[model samples]
Target: MSNMQTLRFYVTPSHNCSYLPDQKAKTLFVDPQMRISTDSYSQLSELGFRRSGGHIYRPHCEGCNACQSIRIPVELFKPSKSQKRILNKNRDIQVIRKFPIMDHEYFDLYKSYIDQRHADGDMYPPTPEQFHQFLVEGSIDSWFYEFRDTDKKLIAVAVTDHLHQDMSALYTFYDPAEEHRSLGTFAILWQISEARRRGMNYLYLGYWVKACRKMNYKTAFRPLEMLIDGHWTHYRQE
Candidate 1:
């Protein structure tokens, strides 16, 4: 028996749903900070546990099913010429993996990302403590990938989790000052590379909202499979 095989779970009370308008949402979470094995984490992910911060959660809302778990099939991933160019453009950036941490620099970068990219959003001007709580205090296999330049300037960071068969991208933010670099796309490309290196087949990109321009970029990744009605349907690019 592996550590991940152990059963541990908790349910959250209904909260105002962030995804859909006028819908209440509840979540069932498995704390990764608890004494769970890596095997269990993989099992939970297959069972629909999406990592956020340090928590693994599955939708448990009553009667509402707007939330869906999504993953990208790495075997079929083929970078377009433009994506390859973006990768080439960011060739100088270095990615370092570290246990998630809350610090002044990270908080500042987060604030800058929010202010520039999501000013009218709920996370606008998030307090340091709040940012820490959201990014650090959770239960599950989570880590942060920090992207830096030659001078070690922090350009971007992505908090993600490793599951048995896949990697789940939790949240990512960048300096915003380096817009020309397209850090968001670069980060996803890096995750794909990391996933291939880890021998994982999937990279779980949370969701793709058709109506949201901010989310529309996710569709640009080739050979992605969107979760539809509990099935991963292949999406082809014309």
Candidate 2:
């Protein structure tokens, strides 16, 4: 593996913020042309960088620092009452981990999720090209954890990256009709268990925006550590 110290970094031009309205945001990203090693990727993740398809980046907005990277220390984590309920609720769902692929079943679920839940977001009008590029195109060590029901129907998919001593929960999409199941929460809980079982130390959750309601779900995971001013500290909710 090439030394990560040799990797080049770039900064994207300021653009409209996705999490905050009327705010501009920029990103600090590693050179896209480089094939980052698993160790290097994990190291970057520890420093608050995230993967989106082929890009490894972190929020680098000039004046706004709302995007804080978060991770759960698996050994130190304990599920909340609601999280346990989610696990119980999803007992019938089977999770299978496989290499990332551009399968139709996966894309269909992703399309349904983005089209319905995030129509107002940038990924609306989902296309196969977009789906493939966003989730399956990355060269990093990634896997797709398929969530299936008793009838063996695909319900949700969690794209996760296995890093050096941790795992990163990249993105998750599920059946809109299964909203009552809280499959998203279940996916995270399962990842936590899986990480612990694998002897990994943490599960990196991309970022948490305090002012964004959509990001509120991230806080429910107790003992979460947030990267603050280049330090990872236990997050205390206000």
Candidate 3:
């Protein structure tokens, strides 16, 4: 099953939670020395692990299990009214997929997205080295989908990884000024559709924290499956 059971993982020191305020988070990551193949990475993904550039990890908090890895079953995915509107609104933008590289244009848009939208977050004051390490480096096959306006100006970039039966979204950054476009939601919709088009079964959206407002949008996609206690089950909002 992709040599997953044989790999070793280590835990990271506790750090401030990126989603919940004041809460600490620990992550379990695949051993850095182990070489990962596409099949092995896909197997690891099935276990709730996610890619973070050079490393693959998932939340390993000692006392908390707030982070639930979520994914969209592409074939069963039905876009809601709002998502359809987002698709209609972004019809003008062009989506092009290419190898994951530190293109100057992509980096510039990433810088802008961080500077204006996430200035208060940890990624504020973005740097070239951080960009390369956090988004460009990975063990498995990965790529970037560049979203451009009519004038060919880049507005969004989705860093994604191609795995066994699913396409995992590593990260997505768009022009914060294009808030009206709802690019973030649109990114997921497009990914879902694109994954279906490519014969993929699922589109992994990473973790969804029930109490985190920032993660509330993840539930908007119907029939979403969340990994809880090592089992993937459909999430029904109560």
TM-score of each model, paired residue for residue? 0.85, 0.98, 0.95
lDDT of 2 by residue, 25-61 (tens): 9989998888899989988998999999988999998
Per-residue alpha-carbon lDDT of model 3 for 46-160, expressed as tens digits?
9898888788888999889999999999999999898899999999999998887887888899999999988998887999888998998863778889999999989999888
Q: Which candidate has the top score in lDDT?
A: 2
List of clashing residue pairs for candidate 1: 3-37, 4-40, 31-139, 32-139, 32-140, 33-139, 54-139
Deviation from native of the Cα of residue 2 in model 1, angstroms? 9.8
Query: lDDT score, residue 136, model 1?
Result: 87
* Per-prediction backbone clash count: 7, 0, 0
For model 3, the stretches where C-alpha displacement exceeds 4 angstroms are: none
Better of 2 and 3 by lDDT: 2
**What C-alpha lDDT values do all the predictions have?**
0.80, 0.93, 0.89
